[model samples]
Target: MPARNEAGNLPALVDEIAAALASRGPFEAIVVDDGSNDATPKVLAELKRTRPWLIPLRHAVSCGQSAAIRTGVRAATAPVVATLDGDGQNDPTFLPAALDALAAGGARVGLVAGQRLGRKDTGFKKIQSRIANAVRGRVLGDGTRDTGCGLKAFRRDVFLALPYFDALHRFLPALVRREGFEVGLIDVVDRPRQAGVSNYGLWDRLWVGILDLYGVWWLIRRRRQVPEVTEL
Candidate 1:
């Protein structure tokens, strides 16, 4: 998980996620610090010293969540990668279930996105998300209900193949679909924020999302399709 200034929530979030994954056996938790100005790096370093499973990476400057995600993905040593927001709003318990869905191989699904049920965001934020989701669904036709939900899992190879851009993290379903992979949706629990303020606002996301939507659309249209050759 890529975390930025998430010092207050990191301890609990890491602990809960670790405990949840313990039931399924070993899994490494890569915590990438996205140039956090707060004590996030200190906390991660301390944790890493004791917990070998907790790997830590730090960016010299603050990058957007998308960049942080790319860093973490590159550092991932596992076949399957799961991502969740650092704010602790996404439930870790649903991770194993998302992995199970991916393993089922329903139509070569490349990404499994968790749909946040009963979101706990402010009314304004929720309204903005609803509008954005409606627009994205109409434009992309990716069949994903909640692309904004942070909890997601997919094959590591599939994730590394996608083009990188700022805020492109929100369009994973559509991008993965363009690669001829199906997207699976699963319902996940949402929780109220326990610490720190949200990094996004309504107007900023709205304006940026509009531009990103068009950019993704053009990329999708211009994408080249090549047949896979098994034996020459």
Candidate 2:
């Protein structure tokens, strides 16, 4: 989890996710501090002291969400990696379901993305996301309905193969598909933010997404195509 200025939500979010993971099976949570200017560091330190599973990585300067995610993934010790928004909107209970989907879908499924069934966000934000998803689906042809949904899981190697960018987190399905791996989507419930404020607004994300979409499109066009080779 890449957390920034989430002091109010960190404690509950950490506890709930930890309990949920414990209920299903064994898992570890890595809390990456993206240079938070709030009490998030103190809260994370406290949680780490109490919970052995929690690994905390602190950034001296804010490097945005994508960088934080990359840092966390690199520090992960598990073969399978899962990510959830630190804003407390994503339910950690659905993690098992995502894992099961990947297992049932087989090894070809490189990434399992969660599609938020019922989102709890402001009207403008929802509308913007719908527009972005539609445009992205048409262009990327990734067959993913909700790319912005934060809850997702994938093989560590598959994730490492993708080209990392500033907003690559939002277009993970497309990136995974580029590596000739299948992408799976599962419906996950979204909840209202438990505490703190959302850092993103409609316009900010919309403009940034438009630029990123074009960049990804160019990457797809330039993708190398090679024929299969067999060894004797």
Candidate 3:
């Protein structure tokens, strides 16, 4: 999970994820403490002692959510990786289903994006997301309704190969499709934050997200074609 100053939310969130994933199979929960100023580091440190499956990574300075995600993925030892928001809004209960979707989608499927069914955010946040999704769809044509949802599962290699950007997390569906892969979605019920304040501001990212959308559109247009070949 990518987190900045989310100490109030991390410990319980981690435990909840572990409990949810317990009966399913082996899973490690990695928390990327993205230069948090609070007691986040201390909390993670304590959790590590009890939850050995928990992997802790620290960034010297806050590099945004995208950077933190990239860092965690790079350090991930699993073939498939699952990402959750540090704020505990994205339900961990949906992770196993997402994993199943990836497996059932066959090898060509590179991503399983979680689409929030009934989002628990405020009216303003919901409207901003709706508008953003519409604009992004029209521009990039990624065919995903909710790319901003934090719950996602995908092959680690597929993510590592994609071009890195500050807001890459928001455009994952389009990027995954651009790499000759399919992206699947599963509906999930969103939850309100367990504690603390939200670090993200829709207005702060509105302009940058627009630019990123257009950049991705150009990328799709310029994407190179490869010919099928066999060894002679």
Identify the superior model by lDDT, candidate 1 or candidate 2.
1
Write candidate 3's Cα lDDT for 73-190 as tens digits: 9999999999989998998889899989999998789999999998999999999899999999988888999998999999999999899989999999999999898999999999
lDDT of 3 at 8: 90
Q: Which stretches of candidate 3 lie over 4 Å from their true place?
A: 226-232
Candidate 2 C-alpha lDDT tens digits along 29-140: 9989999999999999988988998998999999888899999999999889989999999998988888888888787899999999889998888887888899999998
Regions of model 2 farther than 4 Å from truth: 23-25, 226-231
Q: How much is the lDDT of residue 151 in candidate 1?
A: 91
How many collisions between residues are there in candidate 1? 0
Q: Per-residue error at 23 for model 2, in Å? A: 4.3
Would you give me the overall lDDT of model 2?
Answer: 0.89
Q: TM-scores of the models, in the given order?
A: 0.96, 0.95, 0.96
* Model 3 residue 6 lDDT score: 88
Cα-based RMSD of candidate 3: 1.3
Candidate 1 TM-score, true structure as reference:
0.96
